[model samples]
Target: MKAIVTPGPRPVTDPSALLDIDAPEPVLGPRDLLVEIRAVGLNPIDFKVRRIREPGETAPDILGYDAAGVVTAVGPEVILFKAGDEVFHAGQINRPGSNAERQAVDERIVGPKPRTLNFAQAAALPLTSLTAWELLFDRMRADPDEEETLLVVGGAGGVGSALIQIARAKTRLRIVATASRPETREWCLDLGAHAVIDHSGPLDEALTAAGERAPKYIASLTQTPRHFEALVRAVAPQGVIGMIDDLPPGPFDSLKSKSVGLALESMFTRSGQGTPDMIRQHEILAEVAALVDAGRIRTTLTEVLGPMSAATLREGHRRLESGTTIGKLALTGF
Candidate 1:
């Protein structure tokens, strides 16, 4: 199999940060599916992991998470899917990922690809969709009938794009998204945000100027530390804030004054820890696919950079690091 592997932790600017190499076929587990990958999606986690995590001495570390593919084979205990089933998934963080020509993923976390979308489109959904879905529904426990406001920061990014659409389709919360640039703001509105505010300024003022109230739920999708204080001030009393980004220890006591609740959402936690409810990811993806097929949701894929190669992936990482991309970036074929 041809796989793109990071030799060690290095910046994306480093020419050797990622390399294209031939690797052996992946071995399967009792509840795994061997997928022949057709396309892959890039996320901030790819570059973050590249900069911090070192590859194991015995095997290379594959860096992709979101992928769409066909099942080539299934493990003995696998019942969710069979050979030739078209599927998509965000493979576990602890496993070899979808940067390769083929990958072994747990069937409990995989879902049928949306029939309305192609491989590249389906690949762009898994990781971001799971993150958004879990953050809004599972972690925050948003009520479908509640009319309270939900503010989303970094509204044009991968997870933000999905968050806006899913919230609009599944809940009644007034969606307020933050985007600094005109194009990004338009993108958020197009995705079903009730209002869009600039994140470059103080978020509380932005929300006020946009005619939105103190949000009952705040999703700080990026640069949490920089926005932490403003978020603490902007949320409603006893409101909840959900975050997925890694943040340094800060003045959490600030939130105490408002009696605000904090929730951390990590899409990898279930599969990473082999949690009892790991199958929830599969159910979430299944619902997302249904939404897509029913025209209630759409893929966030913005551009296809090219085939899966080290140079292409490095360029994708560089673009993500630039922090200006409107939606998800994807690559098709090996």
Candidate 2:
């Protein structure tokens, strides 16, 4: 098998940040599926991990999360899928990732790929979809019948895009997203956001101008600490806010005054700890696939860099670090 790996955490600008090399076939566990990867998706976590060395780590680490592929074999305990079954998953953080020709993934966290999409498109959904779904329904506990509002910050990114479509299709929350540019604002509206506001300006005033109320729930997709105060002012009393980004130095005591509840949505939590509810990810991805096939939601993939190679992946990393991409980036074929 061929794999891309980093010798250790290094700056993305470093010439040897990532390299392609031959590796052994992955070994499987009782509940594992050995997948022949057809495509892989890139996320901020890829670059973040590259920039910071993990403590006590002595070997090169394979770094990827989202992947879509065909099952080549299954472990003895696997029942949900078999050889030749098409699947997609965000593999566990503790295990070697999917940036390879083959990977061993727990079947409990894998789901059937959307029938309407290609491998690149399917690969783009898993990580972001799980993050958005868990943040909205699991962490915030949104009600489908409630006529509340959801305010999404950094609305043009992958997770933000997924968050908007899911909230629109599955809940009655009036969706409001923040985008700084005209094209990004239009993209959010086209994806089912009821209103699009500019995060570069005052969020509260933008919400008011859009004829929306203080949101009952806020999904801060990025720059959580930078927008903390504004989020506190823009949320209704007793509201809940969820974030999936790194929070900089700041005090959250203001949330206490408003009875605001805060939560962090880390998609890797279930697989990282081998939780009892780990199967929930499978259910979530299965539901997302149905939504895609039904035309309720679509893939966020915007760029497909050629084949899976170290050079192409490095360029993809540069694009992500530039912070100008509108949606997800993927690479197809090994």
Candidate 1 has its poorest 10 consecutive residues by lDDT at 52-61
- Please, what are the lDDT tens digits per residue for candidate 2 over residues 10-81? 677887889898877888999999999999999988888777756335233788889999999999999899
Clash numbers, per candidate? 0, 0
Candidate 1 per-residue lDDT, tens place, 51-85, comes to: 88776932668878999999999999998998999
Q: Cα miss at 205, model 2 (Å)?
A: 2.7
Q: How high is the lDDT of residue 10 in model 2?
A: 69
Highest lDDT against the true fold, candidate: 1
Can you give the TM-score per candidate against the true fold?
0.98, 0.97
Best by TM-score: 1
lDDT (CA) per prediction: 0.93, 0.91
Residue pairs whose backbone atoms clash in candidate 1: none
Task: Quote the lDDT for 234 in model 2.
Answer: 88
The alpha-carbon deviation from the true structure for residue 177 of candidate 1, after best TM-score superposition, in angstroms, is: 0.3
RMSD of each: 1.1, 1.3
